[model samples]
Target: MTARTARAVDVPVAGGVLRVGVWDAAPDAPTILAVHGVTSSHLAWQLLAEELPGVRIVAPDLRGRGQSNAVAGPAGMAAHADDLAAVCAHLDIAPALVVAHSMGAFVAVVFAHRHPALVRRLLLVDGGLPLSAPADLSPDELVAAILGPTAARLSMRFADTAAYLRFWRDHPAFAADWSPELEDYLVYDLVPVADGGAALRPATSYATTVEDTVDMNTRPTVTEALDDLAVPTVLVTVPRGLQNETPGLYPPAHLAALLARYPAVEHVAWPEFNHYTVVLSRRGAARLAELVTAQLSLSVA
Candidate 1:
């Protein structure tokens, strides 16, 4: 396969610059801005970007991740939505469609809610609705159980880039279908650290983690925000999220309710996908692109 030329640019935002990746093809084609999950960067959409053709694809390294690490000021979805608005304005392209993965999906929903004028449609991959916790549990306990491993991974300063790639390969979710593109993604996500070592720079800080946990519980508010969303939207869910029973982790039921609430919402559940692979897997990426294309085609027709 020929390597497509990709460009990285930083667009100024409120507190800092938002790093954006452009997969430019045809200017007349519809534009799609990809919002990555928490602790993810523009590379999150690598596989999916490759599949989508003839479109101006904008993948922004959300605040505090990848090249956008400096724009970590936003504590919740609202803040991210605003940052996205700024980036869209900078690009001078109206929001064509938004395809968001995981936490990026949450930010995309909030963005569409806040700036309806910009978004023509929304494709939420394994995200969109907020996380939920048992009424009895404390947020601290929930976060530690659900996100502690991720926090630990980000904190690790790898001795070399290859070691980091190995770490991802050994992971339960990604081990089965690891590829060269994923290797490039892992390398891009890392930065050289002091003491002649490298580390993940877009590490989700404690503040951001806590903020996300809190925001996850704000599904009601997000629903209210989406109540009047004029833009069409779809939610794509993975099997792990629905079947896995890791305590303290957010459940898929919350997302179901959100889908039920919106007249314009559509939901798809793929049993073959895990939380991460829903956007990374070839089938999953094809499914995601198909959904977005189908929606856009319907709109244009």
Candidate 2:
């Protein structure tokens, strides 16, 4: 069966409401709580939703990103985890499988730990493992260095949506895998600035992005969750980083050590894809759908 168009919903939470994208399959179909990256919106799961027609996919535009950019209070792993729990409570889904990408993976880990009863499994895509950081850099500097161009774009202003699309079209990571779905995702990220001009700016808050980046690196919640992890988790890594460069976020040796420490966690490497393409590309989404479907079957068995 072909997937249906996604429906948007606003779920109330502490401080503000979270805008969620729902790909409803059936009333009783297995639910997957998908989460996007730091700079992404719920639309990131569009391709994945199409790949799994029998499963219901729910993704939220986390506070400080996408349509939920106005959410109040601080942005951190703990706060995000709490918000996710509230979302699950609002949806009334128990033991849901969570599929998270990039920084979303960090949030998923903490959510599984904080609300163990709400999550049955975790699918971490290209994130969640401890990253190597320079101890000398401050939080702000760390964020700048880690995010690179992705962070730089937040401070920039575009003449129009077309200009923003042009910028992304030139990006090394997305240039080769460009598609209408990706264009839609980028278009949704743009918000009109109030300078009495036609130019638009990114919806993501710079302060929130910096705060979350720092928290992801220094937060104890992620490490604590890993230490006491009881949920079955699978991590999928790509061979390229955000810039489409080789020696991706998790190097082979680094991942091997991480797996050794967390022996219960399963790891899979997709050499053909990159950090962004893992969920944005057709092949990558298909592979992820297979994993989600297999896990859903296990959950019911």
* Most TM-score-accurate candidate: 2
The models' CA-based lDDT, in order, is 0.72, 0.89
lDDT score for candidate 2 against the true structure:
0.89
Clashing pairs in 2: none
User: What's model 1's overall lDDT?
Assistant: 0.72
Model 1 worst lDDT window (10 residues): 241-250
Clashes per model (N, Cα, C within 3 A): 0, 0
**Highest lDDT: which candidate?**
2
- Range of the 10 consecutive residues with the lowest summed lDDT in candidate 2: 1-10
Query: In candidate 1, what are the lDDT values of residues 1-301, reduced to their tens digit?
Result: 2245569888998778878999887757888888988777788777777777666688888777777766646567888888888888888878568889877887888888898888888888876765555555576666665555665576677767777777777677675667777778778877666455444442445567667656766345466666766777877777574223232123556655656667577777776777777776666677777787787686566
- Tell me how far candidate 2 lies from the true structure as C-alpha RMSD in angstroms: 1.2
TM-score, predicted candidate 1 vs. hidden true structure: 0.88
TM-score of each: 0.88, 0.97
Look at candidate 1 and tell me the lDDT of residue 138: 70
